[model samples]
Target: MALAGKAAVVIWNDVTPEARSDFLAWHGREHVPERVSIAGFRRGRRGRAVSGGPEFFTLYEVENEAFLGGAYLRRLNDPTPWTRRVMPAFRQASRALCRVEFSLGAGVGGFVATAVLPELADADGAFRSALQRTAEALFAAQSALTGLHLLRCDANASREKTAEHGLRRETPELPAGVLLAEAGDAAPLADVVAGFSEKMASETGRRFEAGRIAIYRLELCLAAGEVLPPWDGSPTFAGEGD
Candidate 1:
C-alpha cells in the first residue's frame, strides 16, 4: 500500500500491573476494531513490548488528523461510568505522532520482527540515553520524523508475548537495530541505516546483526463502539476520544 498521511505512534505506560491487563484487553476487545470503522482510516497495527516500553507500547495510524484530535477526544470525555473509569485512570509519560512528509521503502513485513537497540555498557541507562540522542539528532537533522516515544518495559515476560498481540505479529523476532526513525526518501533512509549500523559497530566494537531486525510501520483506526477484531493478524481501531 502507498504510504498514508498523518501517522502516529502512541506510547502508553501503565501505572501498575492491574492497569496493564485492563489496557491490553480493552484495546484488543473494544478499541482497535472501533477505530478501524472510522471513515478515511486505512490499515492500523498494534505493537507490544518486544524490547523497550512502559510495560506496553501501542501504535495507531489513521488517514486524518481530525479523528485523533476531535473525534477521539470526544470519546474520552464520554460520561458513561465504564468510559469514565478507563479514561481517567490511564497515564501517559509521552505521546508523539506526525504526518508522513516523505518516505521510501515499505514497512518490514514478516512472521517475526526484531529491533536491536545499542547494547549499552550500562544496560539500564545506555539504551534510553541513546534513544533520546537519536531522536534529537533526527529532529535537528530536519528529518521527517512525526512522532517519538521512549519506554522501559515493566518486565521481561511481557516482551515474549509482544508478537501474540494482534498488531505485533507482523514482525515476531527479538529486536537488534533501531525500532523507529524518520526518512525523507529511500536514499536518506538507506544512508541513515548505514550510518546507524556503522556508529553502533564502532561504539560497541561489534557489528550489529541485520537478519534479526526488520522495518515496521504503524496505523490508527477509529470507529464507533464495536467488538474488536480477533488476533488473527487483522488491523483495527478503538475509539478513545481525543
Candidate 2:
C-alpha cells in the first residue's frame, strides 16, 4: 500500500529497563488502541533500537495535517490515568508531526533506519525533486531495503509540547525532514543507508547533520481490533478517583 495517509506522527524515546514491562503493557494494551480509535488516526507501529541507545520509536499514521493540531492535540492534553502513570517514566522523548511526502514499499520489515535531515532555507522545490530522484534510484536497485519514505515536519506541531505533562527532558528542536529506510537485516541496511545519505548530500548539496540517524529493530506491533493478552490486574483509568 502506498503510504496510507497524508500525515504521520513520529515519536522516539526510551524508558528504564525496570519499567520496560509496564511501559510495553501500557503502550501495547492501552495507548496504541486509544490513539488508533481517535477520529483521524489510521494505524500505529512501534520499534526498538537494535544498536542505538534510548531504544524505542513509534509511528502513528494520520489522515491529514489538521489531525495533529486538532484531535491528536486534544488526546495528548487529556491523558488517561494509565497514560499519566506510564508517560512520566519516558525519558529522552522526541516527537514530530510530519507531512508524508513519499512512500515506496510493499511490506513491513525486521529493521528500519531513519535519516533526519534539516530543512533547507529557501530551496524546497530543489530539495524535493532531488529526494524524489534518489528515491527512484533506490527503488530501482531492488536491494535489501524493503521500504523507503519521506516526511516533512509541520513546524507548529513539531514543538516539544510534552513539557507541560511533566516529563522533564528538554524537547529536541525538530528536524526539517525525515528519511526512512527499512530492511530485514540491520547491519547491511545501515551500510546502505550511510551510502545513500552520502549520495543524497552530494546530489542535493545538503547535509543531514542536525539530527541523529539510527536503526531500530521491530519489537512488538499492534493494530486496531487485535486482541491483546488478557490483563487480569487491577483496573486503571485516568479520571478514576483513587
Candidate 3:
C-alpha cells in the first residue's frame, strides 16, 4: 500500500423495494466502473447503508492534490458519456471528505456512522442487539464482507472540531461507530452495496429510516512518523491519536 489522497462521496437517495436488487447490481457492475475510469482515479468502491435508508458511500483514490484540483473537477462534473448514462440510477446528495493522505496499511478501511446512537440511546441492550443484527444482515447479504467492529467511546477519547463542511469530533459520550470491509479495489464494491440492501430489508422488517442512518468513507491517515504494521493476521486497534 502507499500514501494516496482519498476522496469519498456520500449520497442519500430514494430507492424502491422493487428496484433495490437492480440498483445494487447496477452500481457494482456499471456505475462504479465508470467513475473509477476517470483520470486521477486509482481505486473506487461503493457501499450501502444497511438500515433501509437512502444513504450510500463511494470512495475514490487519487494520485495527489493536483489530480483532485481544477482538471479533476472539470472531468467529474463533466463526466464522460458513460457516466452520463449511469447517473440516473442514483439520487445523490454529495459531501466531500476533506483531503487526507493515508499510509498503505493492513486494516480493511475505517468508517464513522453518526446520527444513529441518538435513535438507539434510549433503548440500551435492545439497541445494541438491533445494531449488531443490522450489521450482520449487511455482511450476510454481501458475502465479500470480512469484519465489522463496534467501538464504544471512552471518556478520555472525546474531542470535537467544527468547520464549514460539518462538525467532526470523537467523544465517548457521543457513541461512535466504525466498520471494516475487505476490499482490494473498486471493482468488487458493488456486490457489497447490493448485498447491504437485502440484508437491511431482512433485518429491519422492510422499513427503512432515512434520517437515522449516516455512512462515512474513511482514508486511514497515520500520524506523523507512524509506520504501517506488518500484516500478521492479528487483531489490532489504534488508540486515540495514534
Query: Which candidate leads in TM-score?
Result: 2
Model 2: per-residue lDDT, tens digit, 100-207?
888887777688887777653334888778878888897668577778888888777677365334553535667787777877888766666676677678887766
* Residue-wise C-alpha lDDT for candidate 3, range 16-98, written one tens digit per residue: 45656665555554545555555565666455554334456554555544554454455545554444443444443333322
- Count of clashes, each model: 33, 1, 2
TM-score per prediction, in order, is 0.44, 0.85, 0.39
Per-candidate local distance difference test: 0.41, 0.74, 0.41
Quote the lDDT for 101 in model 2: 84
Alpha-carbon deviation at 203 in model 3, angstroms? 37
Better of 1 and 3 by TM-score: 1
In model 3, state the lDDT of residue 59.
Answer: 48
- State which candidate, 1 or 2, has the greater lDDT: 2
- The lowest-lDDT stretch of 10 consecutive residues in candidate 3 is 162-171
RMSD of 3: 16.6
| Predicted structure 2: lDDT | 0.74
Question: What lDDT score is found at residue 2 in candidate 2?
Answer: 45
